[model samples]
Target: MATFSLLVTANPHSSQGQFSAIQFAKTLISQGHILKRVFFYADGVLVASRLNCPPSDEYNLTKTWAKLAIEHDFELVACVTVAMKRGITNAAEAERNALTGDNLDPAFEISGLGQLTEAMLESDRLVTFG
Candidate 1:
């Protein structure tokens, strides 16, 4: 079984790439592959925002990603640089930056590009969606 890492660079609500990536991850897991990590970059960091709320009838990719990660025991990491620039932050980051509040979801972590490099080095395949 191939060990995989995923890079997502698309906005969750504005693009189809996020959905495609999610489905791809599910399929790979079902095929008995190991998912090492999923890195959210650029606008993809929005998926880690706790403030994201879709309509009751619409699909919530953020929640979906969180649930999937919890079920599969994989990491959901967002780019710290991009996330902060987009106003998404954890408590530590918010305090450090002197922001009024944090909106980053608890299910996601904020980290640097080294995490992405590590994922690429450790996984058998690194797939990008955007």
Candidate 2:
């Protein structure tokens, strides 16, 4: 199985892009593939927001991603710049920006663009969902 670096650039709940990405990632892992990172960029930053609360009967994309990341031991990295622009700050960023709260999910991390570059370099395949 090959190593993959998945990039997601769609809103988690508004469309099927995020759902497809998650399903593909699961398939890869189930098939014995290695996922290096799941990078959230553009509108995809919404996938990492801790404040995302879908309807009771709906599937929670953020929670699904979190559980998969933990279960698979893969990195779920949200683009720091995009996340900040969308107000999806973690504790450190919120403190630096003087925000009253932070909402980035604990399952994911905020990182620079270099991490994305490195993921591509290390991965055998780069998959994008946008």
Candidate 3:
């Protein structure tokens, strides 16, 4: 089975990119392929925000991605610089930066772009959804 890395570069709510990434990951897993990593960059960092509460009738892509990461043991990483710039802060960063509270979900980690590069190097395929 091919090992895949998904690079997300769009907002979850604004476009279909985030949903597409999630679906692709799920399909790959179902087909017995491995999802090695999910790298959130640019506006895609919003997927890690715990503050994202989609309406009851709407599909919550953030939660979906988080669950998938936890269930399948895929590395869920967000670019620290991009996340901070977009106001998406994890517990540690929030405390260090004296932010109001932790807005990032625990399912994802704030990391550098090197993780993305590593995923690309390690995985058999690097697919981008944006």
Candidate 4:
């Protein structure tokens, strides 16, 4: 089984790529492959936002991603630069920036490009979705 790391650069709600990435991750895991990490960058950082409230009938992308990560024991990392720029920040970042609150989900971690590089170096394959 191949070990894979994924980079997602698409917006969770506005783009289809994000959904595809999620499906791909699920499929790979079911097939006995190892998904080491999913690094969210660019518009993909939106996936880490806890404030996302999709219609009740719609797919809860953020929650689904979180659940998947927890179930599979993989890392879900959002690019710190993009996430902050997009107003998606963790408690630490919000406090540091003097923001009123943080919208980043607890299930996701804020990190830099180095994490993505490390995932690439450690995994057998690095796939990009966007």
> What Cα-based lDDT does every candidate model obtain?
0.95, 0.94, 0.91, 0.95
Q: What does candidate 3's lDDT look like per residue over 14-110, in tens digits?
A: 8999888888899999999999999999999988898899899999877888888899999889999989988999878989889987888889899
Rank order (by lDDT, best first): 1, 4, 2, 3
User: Model 1, 21-82: lDDT tens per residue?
Assistant: 99999999999999999999999999999889999999999999999999999999999999
Better of 1 and 2 by lDDT: 1
By TM-score: ranked, best first: 1, 4, 2, 3
RMSD per model, one decimal: 0.5, 0.7, 0.9, 0.6
* Residue 32 lDDT in candidate 1: 100
Backbone clash count for every predicted candidate, in the order shown: 0, 0, 0, 0
**Which model scores highest in lDDT?**
1
Model 1: per-residue Cα lDDT at residue 65: 94
TM-score-wise, the better of 1 and 4 is 1
Best by TM-score: 1
Off by over 4 Å in 3: none
User: In model 3, where is the ten-residue run with the lowest total lDDT?
Assistant: 60-69
